[model samples]
Target: MTPRRIAFYAPLKPVDHPIPSGDRQMARLILRALEAIDPAEIGPVEVASGLRVYDGAGDPAAQARLSAAAAAECDRLLSLYAAEPARRPALWLSYHVYYKAPDLIGPAVAHALGIPYVVVEATRARKRLTGPWSAFAAAAESAIEQAALVLCVSARDRHAVEAYGPPDQQVAMLPPFLDLPPAIDRSETASPPRLLTVAMMRPGDKLASYRLLADSLSRLAAQPWTLDIVGDGSAAAEVSALFAPFGQRVRLLGARPPADLAAHYRAADLLVWPGLNEAFGMVYLEAQAHGVPVLAIDNAGTGTVIRDGVGGRLTGPTAQDYAAALSALLADPSSLHALGHRARAHVEAHHALPAAAQRLRGLLTGLMS
Candidate 1:
């Protein structure tokens, strides 16, 4: 059978971008899932374009410049695909389309090529329509309106997307997922229980998560547990300062590649992060894949990934509540291991790559026919 070619694009960050982030990680995972889905029926996905239309600062000037770049990219892609009919995709998939980073090129090129345009994670920020990000928000909304199907990542995202969805548009949830990691030994816990955190040291929310985590940990100082942080970024000094009081109890190993993280996940009992504003964190999935349970301040996004008493425990978004939750878990050492068992099982059954690939396959194949 001749393969049905698919074109993939990520305006926020390309899959091959050097930066390490949850958004980039999810983008990469979605690409892999697409490739893994029925190869005989779907051709190898092509990176449609490297041109980024991101305007994080919401500056009107930047949006104008990015809009021009997107227009030029569309012209270039239209010509290229026209020159080679076989290279033209049957479907176009754009990942992570939102106000901060809109799919300005995907919709235009897909419309011109007359292909079914699919969006993996499209967010609708109506509030941004009149804010500093008004121009980018308008472009994002326009691009979303043209999508044949929008695969939202969480229920929080699904509400707004479905509310604003066009009459013929389809909106479905494609939960965050990751390639399964090798099973952790789970038997090497003679020492104090190990806790892990893997997050970038960026300013704003990222730093805030770290600060809240630090405060939570302070309450558990009496408990016997060690924390290993695996990440680095611009606010490294601030993050380090936040955890400095712990002295030798906390270890910041700097940033590491995805592969290196498996060892840390395997050795840890719980992967803790106060996931403030996280849109279904990839690290939680990563940790659970390795049979390590997760602990996070519960919110719309974290709730999707962390199931209380199932995969892990969730607490109110206060330092005291989070600390108290951790204190209880530490008091009962066996409960941590028990949660770890459920954590691995939960991920294998729901969040594995194969599961995501199947969901994407069913959703996308239905569109083509």
Candidate 2:
């Protein structure tokens, strides 16, 4: 049987973007997952959309211009595929769909091509329909409604996706995973308690997380821990100011490639980041896979990645609560070591590449059938 060909698109961020970010990393990971799977039943996949419209400012004019350009690109792709009788894609697979950046091209192209349309994380909040992102939100909802399947990563998104889903649309859980190698052997006592946080220094939630980290760590001034921050973005100046009070203890390493990040994770003891309104952070999974435990607040997305008290400690959203938890973990090295070990085992068993490839294969096969 011939495998179905899939045209992939990520309107928020292209997988090949030079910037190192969670969304780009996940987009690349999903592409790898789809390609790594046995294509006998699913299909060959290619990224078809490279439009980046998630400007964070919700600029209407910018959104409209990008939407127009994306529509034109859609026509170009349709014409290109039409010229090739044997190589036309049988389906369209969009990676991330939300109010800020939605699939403005895939739904129309897929419909005209008479192919199945699917989305990985189609986050929908009905309340966004009346805001500045109203047009984008409506487009996203229409795309989601036209999709044959919507694969949600977190329970938070699952609720919204299903709430606005078409009656015949399928909703499945595709928990976040990584194409990480096995955990290396590292002594828990070989180094000082090294805390690490890997996130973009963007405005809104990213900056808020930095603030939370600063506030929480301020109370633990006497604690002997070194923090290594591995990310950089437009909000660098503000984020730098937030951690300046920590003196030499906090090292801002800026952005790093995955290979460099993996080495840092191997040397680190704890992955501490206040995941404020995240979508199942890949950093937590990557850290856990490297035998490093995480400390974060329990939310819909972070909760899915960090198992409270098992893989990592999940505390209330208060800085005091987080600081207290961090202090307790630092005070007990043996417990932290045990937690790190469990974290590695948990990731290997559940969040590794093989598992994700299989899940994606099953999802794609189901859609094809």
Candidate 3:
């Protein structure tokens, strides 16, 4: 018998999306893990649909349009499978399913084709049912209910999803993971301590994180440190202004691809980003994989990536507290280097791609039977 194909989809952003983001990176990493699985049994992992169903703005009008688009996509997929039965997939796996960007295409086609449907990095948002995202929210709820499994990337997302998911629906933990970057002989020059931040310049939670970062950096003005920011977006002007006061101390490198950012990661003494709403920041893993330490404010998501005194320091919420913690680290160079060494080891043990592949192999044991 021929190996059955596995269909992979990312509704928020296609795995091959042009822009570089944590979401796109995670989708790519998930595909990598799936490919790392027993490929002979799993078959080729294909991006089933490049149709992006994401609605950044919670506009009801956009949701309606996306609904129509999703319906058309479902129709296209069904017709394609009917014409080419051998090309039909045995399972459909979607990543990053939520109210804003739901897997509108997968569930319908999966149900029609009678294939097992699964979701990773799935979330449950009941409140959106009565808001501008009501239509999409309801659609998301239906898709989650139709899934054979919901592989949550964080404990917080799992708790929220499990509460509303069906009793029989399998919900499992798959910690956010990344492909460990190649080892770099970091030559941390004996200049002012270099602090790095890699995040998009967007509004909402991203903007909030940047604002908090600027405030925290204000407290470190007296200390000798150079900050390099690696990102760009609609709010680039605002992000630049926030760090303008620092002038020579800050260098905005615009946005960089993963390959280009490797050198920056190697040269930096510490990776600093508030990580306001992102519970699964892949950059944290990337930095750690390169043997670089990360510094972020304490929160649920921060806990997953950084452990205080282990990977790096997790400071209190307040800017004062964050600054004080950073200052202490800057004062103790030996401790900072030790933290970087530990951070790399921690990610290698817990968040590497091979570990995720093994977890997937175990979780998907009976999925097709």
Candidate 4:
């Protein structure tokens, strides 16, 4: 029998491209995970129109033109869906529904197609209430209510979906999964306690996280630890400037390829992520797969990734708290080593790609059956 056709939609961009956001990374992983399950089972994944014109000058006319172009693109895609065979897709999967107008277009098409709609990593407790974002979010929620399954990556997101009154059976809680590369040999290296953090240095809260890291490192200048920050974003210059005081102590290795990143994770001792808000940080698993423990804030969605006292320590949401935690861990290298071992084991057992692929395949099969 032919494998069930699974249609995938990523509203932001094609997963294969380099986008400066965790959401894109997650989207890529989801597509990879689904494909790994059964390569032939997945069908053509829709790529959003690669037209992003941010209104930096806040020009209403420019914004209107961009919006009109995006709408036309959505209409074109929907028309293609309508022309396709009625039984083309057994189910439709969309990743990350946010306030962006273009983000909702995928769900709208899926709804019009009259297939089982599934959303992964969708959150609903947004506070912004002005402009197209608010309108888009409202429409997305309406589409979400029509979904047959909502795959939540965290308990917090699960709760948010539950608030929409979807049946309990329809909401599935699947942790963010990673296809970790083979473990690296860290025993031969005599490097100092190397810290790593991989994220896009965007404006707003992300910049604040970089500042917090700078402050935390300043407090522990005497300690023999080096930090390697991976990935680049809008505030790349500002983040580099913030870390300038540390000089050689902190290196900004901007957006290294996947292989290089895997090597860096293997070489590092710990992953420090001080984000003020995160839906579900996948970098924690990536670090753990290379035997690196993560030091993160005990935020709502973060608990799913960082297992306190086992994989890593979870400090309160403050730079001082993070600094204190880092100092204590660095003081006891043996403790950190033990946690690192456990971290690797935990990821291998739970978030490994093969297991995740199997689970995802089962979900798809169930939907189609």
lDDT of 3 by residue, 223-320 (tens): 88899999999999999999999898999999988889988888899998878878668888888888888888788787877778888888888778
Model 2 misplaced stretches (Cα beyond 4 Å): 1-3
TM-score of candidate 3 on Cα atoms, chains taken together: 0.97
Distance (Å) between predicted and true CA of 351, model 3?
0.6
**Candidate 2, 247-312: lDDT as tens digits:** 899999988888888889888889999898888899999999888999998899999888987799
Best by lDDT: 1
The better candidate by TM-score, 1 or 4, is: 1
- Candidate 3 wrongly placed segments (more than 4 Å): 1-3, 185-189
Superposition TM-score, candidate 2 onto the true structure: 0.97
lDDT of each: 0.88, 0.87, 0.87, 0.73
lDDT of 2: 0.87
Give the TM-score of each candidate.
0.96, 0.97, 0.97, 0.87
lDDT tens digits by residue: candidate 4, 1-369: 433566676654546656545666777788777767654655434443444424434344655675676668669866765576543565778777554433445555566655577877667745633553545455556656767787888898889788764564488887877877776555522247888889888887678878887888899988889988997977899998898888888888898776677778877888998766777687887888888888988987678888899888899887789999999988888888888888888888888777877877777667766
Candidate 1 lDDT over 90-151, as tens digits, reads 88999999999999898988888778899988889989999889989988899999999998
